[model samples]
Target: MNTPAALTLEAPAEHPFAPFVRILGKGKRGARNLTREEAREAMGMLLEDKVEDTQLGAFLMLLRHKEESAEEMAGFTEAVRERLTAPAIQVDIDWPTYAGKKRHLPWYLLAAKCLAQNGVRIFMHGGGAHTAGRLYSEQLLDALAIPLCRNWQSVNEALDTGNLAFMPLQDWAPHLQSMIDLRNTLGLRSPIHSLARILNPLGARCGLQSIFHPGYQSVHREASSLLGDNSIVIKGDGGEVEINPDTLSHLYGTTAGVGWDEEWPALSARRHVKPASLQPEHLLALWRAEVEDSYPQLALLSTMALALRGLGTPREQAFEQAQRFWDNRDTSI
Candidate 1:
C-alpha cells in the first residue's frame, strides 16, 4: 500500500513524533512498536532535518531500547543512502571502506598501509578511539605522517596510485556526524553510530565494512541483505574493521552479480599468532615503533590480509602479498 501522499509531502506534525518522545524520554517499556515503514519514515524526517532536536533524541533512545527490526534496518539504510554526500568516483582499485580500529588503531593502520602497498584502494572511517579514552585514529595517522583527504578526488588519487585514504566521521555524512558530536553534550551513543557503519555510500556498489560487536552482526547482516550483494563484513574491534588476535577472523560477504560463497570461512588465530621471540618490553616497543616503521600492526594483520585476498584473489597469495607489503613498507607517510 502506498503511504498517504500527504505524509510524503510535509513533515508529520509533532503529534506523530511526540509519542515516540514520551516513550523514549521516560525510558518507558512496552510501548507499541513502530512499523518498519514508520521507522523508516521517522529516520527520513531526521535526515531531512525535519524532526526537532528533542524528538530526534527521543526517537533514538526509544529505538535503542526497543531494538531495531529488520524492516526498520532496511528503511534506515534507504534513508542514509539518499542522504550521503560522498562524491561518485570510478572504481579502479579492488577495495572499499576499511574502517580502522578506534579502540586500538595500530593493527588497522598497518593493514591500511599494507593494503595500500599492494595497490588495493582503501578508505578507513572513524572519529576516534577510547570513546572518551582521549586516544583517536588521527594520533597514529599523524605518527605515520598520513593525512586526511578533504576532497573525494584526492582520495581517488590515493587509491589509484598508493591505495589508501582516510575519511573521518565529519565527511560523507554530516547529519549523522552531528549526532555523534552530541556524545559530549548528551554523554551517550545513539543508534547513529551504528547507522554510520551501515551507510557506506562512498562505494555502495563495492563498499566493504568491519562488523565489531555481536549486536551489530545481525544488524549489518540484515541491512546488507536488503542491499542484495555489494557488502562484506569482517569481525571488527569496537565496531571498526581492525583485527583481534585472540579470536578467529570470519569474513561474511556478498557481491552484485555473484552471490555469497556458501562455505563461509574463518582464519584461525593460531596461524596468525604473535611472534614468540618478542619480549614484553619489546612488545611495548613494538606498539611504539608501529608509528615509526609503518609496519605497526597486530598479529591479526596477516589474517585480515588473507581474508581480503580471498575475495577476488587467492588466500595464499594475499597472505604472501600482505607480508611483503609489511616487510618493505615505509610509514615514511
Candidate 2:
C-alpha cells in the first residue's frame, strides 16, 4: 500500500471513452472502441484510486462481457509497466512465468523446477490465499521446499544459482498487489489481473508471457507483436506457460528474429496423462515414481522445460530433463 497517494487519475482531453462507459453502465452489449490511450487514462484512475467502486465494478463487468481488446491490454500493460519496479539482474536467461491460472500440486512445481534446475530461471507469481479453498501455487512450492523470496535482490540470487524463485505478489509490486483484496470486496476480476500477467519484468533480457485461455492467448500474442522485440507468448495448460497436453504448443516469438515455430518440432511427444489420487502423500509419491521413469510430473513441467529449451529437444527430452532434476533433487534451494 503506497499510503493512498493523492488522487491523480484523469481521462485525457477529448477522450472518447465516456460513451463506452455510459453505454456499458446502461447494460448495452456492443463493442466499444476504447483506444489504447483512453484505456491508459482508466488505468491512471485505477492507479490513483480515483475511480469509484460503483464505476469500478461496472467497468469490470462490462469489460468481462465485452471482452478485452489487444489495444486495451497493451495500454493497461503500459500503465502496469509504469507501476512495476525493475528486476535486479539483467540476464539473457528467459524463464516462463505462470500466473493467474489453476495449478495442480507437485505437478506444476515439478515442471517449473525442471527448467529452473537446468539454469533456465523459473519465475511464478500469484495472489489469493489457500484459506479460501484447495491447493494454491504457493502451497505447492512450499511442499517442495522452494523459498518464497522477499525482494527483487533475492530473486536474482535464486536465479543465479539455477534454482526456482518464488515470491509473494505484494513484496515486489504493492501498488498492484494491493488490488487482490479488491477481488474479495468486489467479487470481480478487474483489468489489473490481466495487466499483471503480461507486464511482469522478470527475465529482463527476454520477457515471456504465458497465455492460458483461448481468449488471452491471442491477447498475449497481439501484445507481443506491438512490443517490438524481446517478448514471448505461448498457449499452455490452464493458462500456464508450460505445455500440459503433450500436443503442439503454439509459441509466438520473433524477438531476436527467433520464431516460435523454432520449437515446434521439438515439442512432439506423448501426452502425460494426469495422475489421480486424493491423498497429497499418495499424489507426491506417484509424482516421484514418474520421475524415476524419466517422465514429466504433469503438463507444467514439460511445458516449462520445452519453453526453456526453445527447440532443444522433443517433449520427451524436456520431460527427461525435468525427471533428471527431480531424481537428483536438491530438496534445499
Best candidate per lDDT, number? 2
After superposition, candidate 2 runs with Cα above 4 Å error: 1-20, 23-31, 91-103, 130-134, 161-163, 184-188, 254-301, 310-333
Model 1: residue 75 alpha-carbon error in angstroms: 1.7
Give the alpha carbon lDDT tens digit for every residue of 309-331 in model 1: 53565566766766676667553
lDDT tens per residue, model 2, 133-221:
34556656656656677887887777677656777767766756766567667766665666666665663455556666575666666
Q: Give the per-residue Cα lDDT of candidate 2 at 85.
A: 74
Deviation (Å) of 25 in candidate 2 = 5.1
lDDT of each: 0.57, 0.59
For candidate 1, what's the RMSD? Answer: 8.4
TM, every model: 0.74, 0.73
Backbone clashes (count) for model 1: 1
